[model samples]
Target chain A: MTDLLRTPLYGLHLELGGKMVPFTGYDMPVQFAGIMAEHQHTREKAGLFDVSHMGQVILRAESYQAVAGAFERLVPMNVLGLGEGRQRYGLFTNEQGGVLDDLMFANRGDHLFVVVNAACKEADIARMRAALEPDISVTYIEDRALLALQGPAAVDVLAAINPAAGEMKFMDVATLDLNGAQCWVSRSGYTGEDGYEISVPADQAVDLARALLAHDDVMPIGLGARDSLRLEAGLCLYGHDMDEDTLPAEAGLVWAIQKARRAGGEREGGFPGAQAVLEQIASGAARKRVGLRPEGRAPMREGVELFATSEGGEAIGKITSGGFGPTVGGPVAMGYVPVDLAKADTTVFGELRGKRMPLSVTSLPFVAANFKR
Target chain B: MKYTEEHEWLLPEGDLIVVGITAHAAEQLGDVVFVELPEVGTEVTKDEDVVVIESVKAASDILAPLDGEIVEVNEALTENPGLVNEDATGGGWFFKMKVSDAAPMDDYMDEAAYNKFIG
Candidate 1:
């Protein structure tokens, strides 16, 4: 605990009565009001999140095409084709067709701005430096703090501070001035809502967060609500849902790999695990990540064994991430199941405390995405 | 009110004792989302897991404080689990039970001792 790092908003979190907990070596706020209330608040109005723990990096080179082409070798995404001022989700794949880490990268004109998960930031940065450095500069933006303001009312609240924010569409990134601070703003978020993730200077983060929170529609949301919101949105948490051994196709993240990166496309079979990933893309994966709705109110949390039958002979798979989804008003979960049982409305059993409970296999995103697109 | 080390509170009422979690336990558990209660008239042993309470963060088992038969269970918690977080002591009581031994009640902590123990 003594060695835990504190974010830029640590003092502000304590002032706001946030329950601080150790998350990825950082003493972060797990909740302020409560998980359930914060969850509902973000869905209805706006919620401000202090996400400074995530690593922000800038890759620079002679030109945008040069940097994009270098980055395309590490991941299976069409980085070259990504439009300027647009963000795309990407995965850093290993040689075994597994994900090392998942990230969001945007083409910031002359350079690329990337954000990776807190738990994997160090390794991700090291990997990027080793792979792309000397040619394309990988600079970790440690002086900035990232804040995500998300919900249906996010645009209205942010537009009041910076009217230009309203003009940006989903996934569009721009440099905006908020409260005298030049912020790297993106009209996107992890909650599947129309919102913005503002990267502000560390010193100005509190002012920006306070300014946003001053709005009646915007509340201070902690990591607890953030996790629930992402889960309800069917977004995968880096380590929880996919890891070093989890393949993109198996984790339902093949969509992130554009057609150009697939077989027969212009730039195909050049990524780390292109052979296996392309094979899975063409032939289909044996197992798939599917949404699970527990029959009862009890949440079938991670590590709970899943079976094909109530009286099963052997466990088929296990839940990756699961908990009470506040927006759904019940337990929602995601886990790997055989492709045969991954169909919607299919019934599977999760063994909880020695009893087999039925769970219905459903499509992703229990709550519909409210993105402005 | 007699309190157990597990953060359970027992209120003596004739042959039956009203059982519920303390406010400290409720706060520790965060927002209670689901509560699974044992059936009425079910026999329970001391230190045995009787009720299952799940908050948004995690799930925890409420151990039986004394050897008893569950005379009545809190049905309201089944509909709205937040009642436990709202009123943990009064209307949020978990169940009423008839214990086989009243001697154990004296061994448990009193209000003062429980507060000190939590502190």
Candidate 2:
């Protein structure tokens, strides 16, 4: 317990009888009421989450264009095309084109703001510092805390507090007065729902959270339901679904690579591991990420070996993230397998414990996405 | 009836003892989504892990209360694992084992003692 860090909302969580567990470096709640009930509530109404543990970095330079260009050179996204108050999902890759972390990049008028996973914060910051030019200065915003208000009723609840919230589209961001405290609010979340991720000063965090919870449709959610929600939506977690050993192409994140960044293109910018990424784009990756649906009620958890039937029942893949998807009403998983066997409806086998469980390669986003965009 | 320090409850039935997680333990575990039980006829030692109970957040091992040979497992857990959350001390029995050494029963706490222990 001495080693675990606490967020600004720790006191509030304890007051609400949240079951705290060590996650990353913070003592976070795994659940509040319960996982299934909280999950269903979020799907039907709204769920409030304390995400202050995530890293917030501000990139400032002489001009916003310079910082944006410097950031674009480090990742594969089209950062320059982003308008003010717009946010886009980006990934930080290693020298081998493997993802280090997936993060959100926002063009905040004067400067570029970025938010990354808590577990990968140190490494991500070091990587950016090493890659960016000397002119670009990246500052860690340790004085801020982040909160997510998510689900279908999120707009209604937030609109009640700030009527302007109803006008914001998905992936767009704006500075709004949340309980009279100016904060950065982005219409984005990891739960595949219509939600707002608000960044406020640490001191104002508890007040904002309390104000949001006062809404009739909003309830406190914890990490337990967060994982299930993301799993059900087929979203890949940073450490589980990908790592330095996994290339972006093989991880089924080709969408993150803008078309303008393709090989032999005029707008193509030089970045580390550009040659390997281009080659992967042209020849196609050897293996690709896919969703797996196991037969029966048994779950195919991480580290489960996958066998390809066409190749003499060869072990060609491994489960990365797997669990019981409450919304899907069964067990679901995502893993990487040979490109040839990554097609939807393809038969596969997962070795669970000592028994072989029948599985099938299926399309991702097992549940429908409810983003307002 | 007796309870182990690990929060497992046992009731004598014929030559076997019915084993189930306590209500207090179930409430702490939140929702029980999956259960992995040992096969009948398998031998287990006291305090050794013999069953797995998974919630949406994590998976925990259920330790055997005493050394014995497993005689039966709860097949109901295969389809409706939430029984452990609904009635952990009653219908949610995990398995039954034929006692290998009756001496270990002395180490278990009686109902009143177990209640005081939890309190």
Candidate 3:
């Protein structure tokens, strides 16, 4: 606890009975009101998550286009095409077509504001600075904290405080004054539900969190449920599902890569690992990320080796993110398997505890995404 | 009734003994979504992982406290595992085992020792 960093809501989490644990470098709450209860509450009603540990950067250059161009060099996404106030998920790739980090960058009309994973943000910022010119301002905003309001009832609760927030659709962004604090509110979240991520001032975090928690529909959620909810949504976690060795396409994140950067497109290949990524796009990856369903009640956790049922039980892949999905009412998992075996309904076996359990390859998002289109 | 440092409880019943997790263990494990008990007739050694209790976030092993052959398992756990969280000491008892030897009971913790150990 002495060495771990504390979030603005650390004291508040302790007051709310959050079980504190060291995650990355922060003394974060792993659960509050239990994992299952908080997960169910977030799915059925609304839950607020304090995601302040993630890095927030304000990148500025000679011009807005110049800023986008500098960032596009590091990532495979079409940053230049991103519209004003519009947010798009981007991937920072390595020369071998591995993901350096997955992040959200919004075209804020003047400069590009980005949010990156907490564990890799420092290195992520350093990498960006190393590539871009010194004149470009790569400012890591440390005085701000992020909060996620998610679920079916999230829109109504947030809208009550700021009507403009409710009026926005999925993936929409607006910088509004909420309770006298200027915030960047985005109608997007990791949970497979209608939600918003608000970037608020650090000093005002507790007040804003308390105000939101005051709503009957909203409760405070912790990291345990956050993982479960995101897993149910088929979203890949940074360190677990992907790392520097995992290609974006192989991780089922090819959708984040735009066509303009692919082969026979306007921008052929310029980003790091663009050649490998483009080549993989033309010729599909050897293995692909997929969802897995256990035939029994036992959860097939991460590191469990997967095997094809045929050919004397040949090893195929391994579970990356696996756990019991509260919404799905059973154990659900995601792993990388051979391309041939990545199809839905393909039979595979998860070897755990010296026993083989039958697992079926299924399409991701075990629960339907309720994002407002 | 006696307790183990690993959080298992043993209740004497003639030659056979019932084993289950303590209330402290259940509370720490949180919501029990699934419980996998060793099959009846299976022989287990002390401190071996005989039962696997799964919460939403993680799976924990309930270690055996003594050498024994399993005689009966709590069938109700398969249908409703949450019973462990509701009543860890009573209906949530995992299995009944025929002790291979009772000498190991000397090393097991009593209620006072177990409570203090957990605290």
Q: What lDDT score goes with residue A81 in model 3?
A: 90
Off by over 4 Å in 1: none
Q: What is the lDDT for A287 in model 3?
A: 97
Off by over 4 Å in 3: A310-314
Window of ten residues with lowest summed lDDT in model 2 chain A: A308-317
The best-first sequence of candidates by TM-score reads 1, 3, 2
Candidate 2 lDDT, A1-373, residue by residue in tens: 4699889999999998899989998999988989988998898999999999999998989877999888977787878778998999888876787788899999999899999999999988888887774788888889888999999999999988899998999999999998988999999999988899999988999998999999889999999889889988889899999987777788888788887777766558466667777778788999988999997677788898998753345688899999888889788899998988899999888887666778988998999999998
Candidate 3 C-alpha lDDT tens digits along B1-119: 89987888999989999999998999899889999989999999988889999998788998888888999999999989989989999999999999979878877899999988988
lDDT of each: 0.94, 0.88, 0.91
Among the numbered candidates, top TM-score falls to: 1
Q: Compared with the real two-chain complex, what DockQ does model 2 have? A: 0.61
lDDT of 1 by residue, A1-373 (tens): 3699988889999999999999999999999999999999999999999999999999999999999999999999999999999999999999988999999999989999999999999999999999997999999999999999999999999999989999999999999999999999999999977899999999999998899999999899999899889999999998889998889999999889999999989999798988988898889999999999999999889999999998947888899999999989999999999999999999999998889999999999999999998
Calculate the i-RMS of every candidate, to one decimal place: 0.7, 1.4, 0.9
- Give the better candidate number (1 or 2) by lDDT: 1
User: Please, what are the lDDT tens digits per residue for candidate 3 over residues A1-373?
Assistant: 4699998999999999999999999999999998989999999999999999999999998788999887888988888998887899888899999998899999888899999999999999999889875867899999999999999999899889989988888877889888788999888999899999999999998999999999999999999999999999999999889989998878988899888777886886899988898888878899999999999999999999998873356678899999889999999999999999999999999997878899999998899999998
Lowest lDDT block of 10, candidate 1 chain A: A1-10
Candidate 2 deviation (Cα RMSD): 2.4
Clashing pairs in 3: none
Tell me candidate 2's interface RMSD: 1.4
